[model samples]
Target: MNSNTFSTLNRDLLLNQLEEETFDILVIGGGITGSGIALDAITRGLKVALVERYDFASGTSSRSGKLIHGGLKYLQNFDIPVVKETGRERDIVYKNARHLVYPIKMNFPIIKKESYNLVTLKAGLTLYDRLAGVKKEERHTIYGKKNTLENEPLFNSKLVQGSGVYVEYRTDDSRLTMEVAKTAAEKGATILNYAEMTDFLKDANNQVKGIVVKDHIDNKTITIRAKHIVNAAGPWVDKVREKDRPVTGKYMVLAKGIHIVFDYHSLPVNSSIYFQHKGRMIAVIPVGNRTYVGSTESLYTENMDNIMVNKSEVEYLLGCLHDMFPTLNLNIHDVISSWAGIRPLIGEDGKSPSELSRHDEIFESDTGLITIAGGKLTGYRKMAERILQYIEKKEKKAITPSKTDHIKLSGAQFNSAEDITSLTTLLHGRYIELNLAEEEIYQYVLRYGSNTEKLLQTISEYNAKDLNLEERNILAELAYTIDNEMVASLSDFYDRRTSYLLFDLDKVKRSLEIITSEMSTILRWDNKKREEENRAMQYLIKRTLSFKD
Candidate 1:
C-alpha cells in the first residue's frame, strides 16, 4: 500500500477531488473526533471528506492528558453514564489500535483522612470495573500502604493509608489520530490538512450546502460541496457554530488544562500515580524516558488562539506533584517541556470549572448545521457512532452500522495483545541484521508497529554509512514522515510527528541543521524559506517550553 497516496504530494489532488466530488459527509476538524467520524462514515459506505486548518491532531487532540481513561473521577461525581460508555470504549480503542493504546496501571494513593476511605474506594472501584466491563481477573486491587510504598517509594508514604490499583489506557494522542486518518484514507476518504473553511456555502434556503475553504500552503481557495457538514472542531466548535448562526441557550465553556514534563530520573516512578490536589485528581505518568505530570483545570477565557501555560498553571501542577510525592523537590527550572489544552466542556453556570461535564452533545441548527462538542478522548469512537446515528436520522438514509470495533488501525496487524508483543520481539531481532542499535530498533518497532519493516527498508536503501546510528535513525524517520504523514514544517515533524521536542529538547537543537538541510532537499525549499522554517520552529519550541525571556 503506497502510503504516499496520503502524502503532501497528493495535497493538490485531494483539493481537486473535494471540488469535483460531492461527499455524503464533510467533516471540519482533523483531530481525533473528526478522524473517528470520517472513518466511521466512510466505512459505512458514505463518501467522506475531512479538512483541517492545521496539521492533524495539532489542537486539543495532541495536547491531551494522553490517557484513554475510563473516567474514574466521573464515578466520584456519581456520573455513571460517561464512566460506562468511556470505560467500555477503552477496550474497543485498544483492541483496534493495540500499538497506539495499551493498558496502564494507575495507583491511586489513599491519603490520611481523605474523602475516599477504603470502603468508599473499594465500592467505587468495583462499580467502575463493572461499568467498564473489566473481567474478574482484571478487577481493581486494593493494596496496603506498606506494599504501595515498597513498590513505588517516590510517594509520600507517611500520609498514605492504602492504594487502589485500576487500569487506564496510555496513548500517543497525535499518533492515534494520525493512524485513524490514514485508515480513513485507505478506505477512500479525502483528508486534507492546512485547509481552513472560510465560510458556509448555503443554498437558496440559507441552509449549509458546502464550505469555501482555503489551503494555507498553496494560498488557493476551493469550494467543497457536500450533502452534509459536521463541526467537530474540538475547542473551536463554538466559533464554527457562530459562522452559521448565533449561539443561544446552551453554549461552551473552555477549561484550560496544563501539564509539565520532567525527566524520568528526576521524578522516577514505576506505575502511573493518581493523587488529589486541592480536592481535584491529577495524574503523573511515565512516557518512555520522561515523566509528565498534569492537568490543572481552570476556566479559560483569555485567548483560545494561543493557550500557553502560564507561570501560575505551571506552579499549580508542580504543587500537585510535590503534594503527592513530597520527596521529589522539583522546581520550575526542572520542567523540560509543557503544554496547555482547552477542554470544550458543556458549561453549567452553577458548576465550577472542574465540575463541568465531558459528555458529548450535538446541536442541529435550523439551517441544518450539526456541531459535536463536549466529548473526551477515550469516548471518540462511541461519540462518532452517536453522531452517525444522528446523521442517519437527519439524512433519512439506511447507513451501515459501525465496523470500527473490529477494524484494526493502520500499522496495527496483530490479532491480540500477545501477538503485538510477539511481533515486536521478532522485528527487534530481525532489524539487528540491518545494523541498527537494539534500543533504536525497539523504539522503531514500538512506534511504527508492523510498519517497522518498511522503515528498515528505507534505512537500508539510504546511503548513510558515514553518519552515526542516531543520525541515520532520525533521517529514516524524517523521510517516512515527509513521504507518508504529510509533514509540512519542521515544527510539525518534531512536535506532532516525532515528539522529540517534548521529551528531548537538546536533541531537537542538535538535529536542527541536518533536518532543515534534508527537508530543504526533499521539499525543494530555497535558503530563505529554510531559514524561515527554522525560525518558526525555534519560536514554537521556545514558546511552548517558555525557554525565552
Candidate 2:
C-alpha cells in the first residue's frame, strides 16, 4: 500500500498499531484543527496518533462558510488584530494549498439604510487591504452605482449606491480537512476515523498519560499510551473535556448557521457578493452551476445530532434575498438543498451569536489535558502552532518550530497558479480525447490538484466495457477515493470527499445506484449493510429538502 493510502482495508492493522505504540502526541478530534496539529507534530519528528468519534470533518469543520478569508466583517467590530493575523494567514494558506484555496472576487454593495456610505466603505476596504497584507493587484477597488449595477444587474436598483470589489479565497472545507489528515498519514501519523475516546489513562500522580479508545468498527477496546493528549474537537470539545474532568472557565456557545442552494440561473451573479439586509450580513456565492446563499447566525439550543434547516430559517434567508434582489422573487420551493451547522464559539455575556468574537482560546485542565475551541477556518495552521508552543512550555523542553507554512498539502504541489492552469489545459485535451466534457476538467483539477492525473489514469485503466464514459468516470472517482482517502461509507464519499450532495444533488441522484453498487463491492458490505447505507443516504437527501414542509 502507498504511504498516503488511508484506506478502510488497513483499519484493523492501523488499530493494532495504535494499541501497540506509545506516542508523543495523541490528538482527539479529527477536524481540520486536529489534523493540522497531527501534521505539525509529525513533521517536527514526534510520534502522533489521532482518533475521531465519527468520520473526519463530520462536524463543524465541514459546515463553514467555505471561505479562506481575512474576516472582512470583523472590521466593523474593530477587531484589527484578528483581521491582521488571519489576513496574513490567508496568504500562507493559499500558498500552501493553492489547489484547495483559490482567489475569488467579492462584491460588497453599499446600500441605502446601511452602516457604510460610499466614502466610508472605501476607507474601510482600504484599511482592510492594508491590514490583511493584500497584494497590490488583488486589493479593493471602488465602483459607483452605475458600475455596481453593470457588475451585478440582479441587485435592487432603488437601494443600491456603490460597491467595493476585493479578493477572498473559496474552498471546499471538508475536502481541505481530509487532505490535511491524509497528508499527516502520509508523513507517518496514525489517523483513524470512527474511533471514539471513551476514557482517560492517568499516572500515579493523576497527571495525564494516555487514552482508552473504542473502535466502533469492530466493537473492540484499545489502550493507547501517550505522553500528552490534546482536545481539538470543534463543537464537541466540551464533551471530550468532560471525559477527563469538569469543563470550567470559558465554555462553548453553540451558534447555528444555515445556508440554502439554488440553480445558478435562479440567482445568477457573475461575482460572489457580500450584501447587507436589515442590519444583517449575508454571502451569495456561485460554484459551478449552483448558487448558494447563506449563513444566518442565531443562538442554538436544540439537539446537536439532529440539526436541520427549518422552514423559518429558510424563510428568513429568502426574505433577505427577496429584499436584496426584489426581481428574483425566490421562495421556499426554489431552494434545491440546504445545510445547517453549529459554531462552537466561546461564550460572552450580553452578546448575540453574530456579535461574538471568533478568537480561539486554549484551556489547560487540572488533569493536564489541553482543549482548543473557537477560531476561523483560515487560522487552523496558526492554531496548531499555538498548541505546540503551549506543549513546549508545559514540558519545559526545546521542540521544533512550525514548518507547516512551507508544507504543500497533498495534491497541491504546483508552484504557481499558472502551473495549475497549464495542467488543466493539458488534462482537458486528454479528457476530450476520452469523450468527457472539457468544463469538468477544471473542477477535477480544483478538487484534486496534480493528483488529478491519478484519477485520469484510473478512468483510462478501468475494465468496465458495459459502462458509459460518465459512469466510468464516476466509478473511477469512487475507486480512487476509496483507495486513497479512507472513504468508509456512502455519506463520506458523497458528502465530504466530492460534495456532490450539496452542490450537485441532481448528479448525486443520478449516480446514486452506480456509486452505491461500486462502494458495496469495494468495501465488501453485506446485503444488510448495503441497505443500511442506502437508507442513510436517502435520509440525508430527504433532510436537505425537509425545509419545504
Candidate 3:
C-alpha cells in the first residue's frame, strides 16, 4: 500500500487507528515541540501517535519572530547555558535543513547615544561565538559604519554609529514545524491534524494509559492507547493537561506577539535588522519580496485560540517602525497583512513578558502523563530529547541517544548557497514535475522542499487543464494534498498547506473555486459535501481575515 494511503488523517482513519493498536507514546499537540517529540520517539523505534486539535502550527510555533538564533539579548542577564544550548541546537537544525534555514547576517543598528555600546556589544558577540562552538562558518564579524551603509543603504545615515556582529540563523517556523511532523510520519509515526485530545485514559492504578480524542472534522470521539502520553500543546498545554490532571501547577502565562508585514520597498534593508523599540527587541526580517516587522510582548487575557491583533498592537508596531527606520515611507496603508499568536511563556513574576525564561520543564502528573512546557522554537529538538530521556528513565527503557542532531527533515535538499533559481526556471521545473505552472513553484518549494517530488508524483496523473488553477496554486497540488498530506478540508490547504489566507486573503479567495473543484473530485464529495467544505473554509477565512478588513 502507498504510504500516503496508510497515513490518511481523515476522521474515520484516525478513529480506526486509535482503536486498532496500542502505541508506545501518544503525543498531544502538533506544534514544533510536539512534532519533535513524535519524531524522537519514532526514530528510537517506539510506536507513536501524534495529534493536533487545529491545523498544524496554528499556535505560538508558527507565529514566532522566525529566528533560530542564540538569544543575543539574553546574554545581558548572564544566561550562558541557554545561549550555549540554543547555539548547538541552532547549528544542528541549520545543518539538517540547509535548504530551508539560512545563515542570515543580522544587522544590529547601533544608534549613536545608547542601546548597545560598541565595546560592550563586541564582547557579547565574541562570547556568543564561543558558545556557538568552534564552527568556522559561524564566527562573529563586526562591520564599521562605512561598510554598514554601503551594504544597507536604507538606514538613516545620520543616526547610524555602526552595526553589531552577525551570528545567527533564520527560518520559517511554520514550515519547520510541519517538516518535522512529516519526517516523523516517514519514520513510522501516526500523525493527525484536526484531532483534539479532550481527555486522558487512566488504567486501574490511575496511571495514564491512553488518551481520549475527538475529531474536529467529523465531530467523532475516539480513544488512543499509549504507554506514555506527552502534552506538548504549545499555548494549549495547560488546557490539555487540565483534562488529565487537576491543573495543579502554574505552567504558562500567555504572551501575545503581533507581526506586521509590508512591501519589500517599504523598508528596503539588505540584511535582517535587530533593533530596540521601546526597550523591546524586534526583528525586521526580509523574506522573499516582503519584509516582516514586528513582535510586541504583552500579557494576553484572551484564550489562546481567540488571540488577535488589537489596535494598540498595530499602533505599537507602527511606532517602532517610525523609530527604527525613520527615513522609510510607511503607515497602516503600507501594511499588507498582520497576524498574532500567544506564546506559552513559563509563568513567573518578572519585570515584563520578555524577561521570562525560555527554558523548558517537564511535569509528571499523578497519572503517568508527562507534560513539557516553557521552551523556545530554537530549542525544540533539545527539549524533545530532554522529555524523551525523562520518559525513558521512568519507563526504564534503554533507548539510543537522540539522533535528531544529524537527521534531515523532509523537503530540505539544498547542498550549496548558490543553488537558488529564478522564478521562470523554478516554475518551468515545477510545471514538469507537479503539473503546475511556473508561478505556483514558489508555493511548492516553500511548503514541500525536496518532498515536492512526492507531491509531483501524486499529481502526475493530472493534465495541464486539471492542474492549472488561478495561477497561484495548481489543482494537482490540491489533489496531492488530499491524497498524500492528510489535508481533510479546504481550511487545511489554505491555513496550513500554503498559508495563502494569512499572507494574501484576496488571492486565496480568488483561487478557492478551482481548489474546491479539484479537491471535491478527489474526495468524492457530492454537491452537499462540496458546499459544506466551502462553507467551513469560508467561515474560517472570515474569522481570521475579518479583523484586518
Candidate 4:
C-alpha cells in the first residue's frame, strides 16, 4: 500500500492496525488541532494514531471564516499576546501550506462615527505589522479617502474617512485540515475518521492506557492501546474529558458564529473588507464567484450537534451589509447559502462571547488524559508543539524537536507563489484540449496543489463519453477524493472534500443525481444506504439555506 495515500478502501486494514499495534500517542478528534498533534508526534519518531467520530473537519474546522488571519479584532481588547502569537503563526502556516493559505489584502474602512480615527487606525495597524513580523513589502498602508473609494467603490462614501490596507491570509480550512491528516498518515500515523471513542481503557492506577473505539462504518468495537492520549475534540473536549474523568477546572464556552454567502453579482466588491458595525467587527470576503459576509457572535447553549443560523443573526448581518454599503440594497432573499460554526472558547467570568480570548490552554486530568481547548485556527501548529512539550516534560521522555515549521505540508512542494503560477500555466497548457478553462485550472491548482497533476491524470483517463464537461470534472474529483482522501459519504465529498455545498450550491444542485449515483457505485452502498446518503445530502442543503425561526 502507498503510505501517502489515505483511502477508504483500506478501512479494514487501518482499523486492524489500530487494534493490533500499541502506539506512543493516540489523538482524539480529527479537526485541525488533533490533525496537527498527530503530524507533530509522528514526525517526532513516535508512533501515533488518531480517531474522529465523523469525517475529518466535519465540525468547526469546516465552518470557519475560511481565513488564516491574525485576529485583528483582538487588538481592540488589548489582546497583545494573542495578536502577536497568532500573527506570527500566520507566516508559518502560509509557508507550510502555501497552496491553501494565501495572502489577501484586507481594507479596514474608516467611518466618521467609528471609534478608530485615521491616526489611531494607522497606529494600530503599525503595531499589528510589528507584532506579526510582517514582511516589508506586505506592510500596512494608509489610503486617503479618494484612494480608498477608488479601491472599493461599494463602500458608503458618505461616512467614510479613509482606510487601512494590510495583508491577511485566506484558506480553505477543511482542505488544510485534510492535508495535515494525510501528511500524518504518510508519516506512519494511523488516522481514521468515522471511528468514535466510546470509553477509556485504564490500568489499575486509573491512568489512561488506551481507548475503546466504536467503528461507525463497520459497526464494531476496537480497543487501541497507546502510551499517551490527547483530547483535541474542539467543542466536545469537555464531554470527552468527562468520559475519562469528571471535569474540574476551565471549560469550553460555545460561541456560535455564522456566515452568509451571496452571489458576486448581487454584492460585488473589489477587495475583502473588514469593518466595524455597532461595536462588532465583520468581514466581507469575495471568493471565486461568490462573496461571503459574516459572523454574529452570541452565546450558544443549543445542541452542539446541530448548530444553525437564526433569522435574527441573518438580519444582523444584513444590517451590517446595509450599513457598510447602502447602495447595494442586500437582503435575506439575496443569500444563496450560509454556515454556522461554534467556537470552543475558554469561559471567563464577566466576559461576553465576543470578549472571550482566542488563546488555547492545556489541561491534564488526574487520570493522565491531556486535553487542549480554545485556540485560533492560525495557531494549530504551535498548539501542537506546546502540547507535545508538556507531554515530554510530564512523561520525562526525550523526543525529537518539532520540524513542522520547516516541513512543508502535503502537495505544497512549490518554492513560492510564482512557482504555483508557473505550474498553473503549464497544466492549463497541457490540458487545454480537455475543455477546462485556464481560470478553472488555476482554481484546481489552488485546491489540490501539486496533487492537481494526479487529478488531471484521472480526468484524462476517464472514459465517460456520455457525460458533460461539468459532470466529468465532478466525477473525477469524486473518484480522486474517494480513492485518495477517504471520502466515504456524499456529504464528505460535497462539504469538506470540496466546498460545492457552500460556495457552489448551483453546481451541487445540478449535479446531485450524478454525484450520488457515482459515489454509491464506488462506496458499494446498497439501495437503503444509497437512499440514506441522498436524504442526508438533501437535508444538508436545505439546512444550510433554511434559517431557524
RMSD of each: 2.2, 1.9, 3.3, 1.8
Better of 3 and 4 by lDDT: 4
Give per-residue lDDT, candidate 2, residue 264.
92
Per-residue lDDT over 299-368 for candidate 2, one digit per residue giving the tens place of the 0 to 100 score: 8888887788989999999998998899998989999998999988887556565665568989888888
State which candidate has the highest lDDT: 4
TM-score of each: 0.95, 0.96, 0.90, 0.97
lDDT of each: 0.85, 0.89, 0.76, 0.90
**Which consecutive 10 residues in model 2 have the weakest lDDT in total?**
348-357
Residues 415-496 of candidate 1: C-alpha lDDT, one tens digit per residue: 6767766776776677666676566766765677777778887787664467776687787788888778888889778988
Model 4 worst lDDT run, 10 consecutive residues: 348-357
List candidate 1 segments past 4 Å from native: 1-3, 348-356, 398-400, 547-549
* Best-to-worst ranking by lDDT: 4, 2, 1, 3
* Candidate 2 root-mean-square deviation in Å: 1.9
Candidate 2 local lDDT, residue 394: 85
Residue ranges of candidate 3 with Cα displaced over 4 Å: 5-14, 165-167, 348-356, 397-400, 418-443, 457-460, 464-473, 525-549
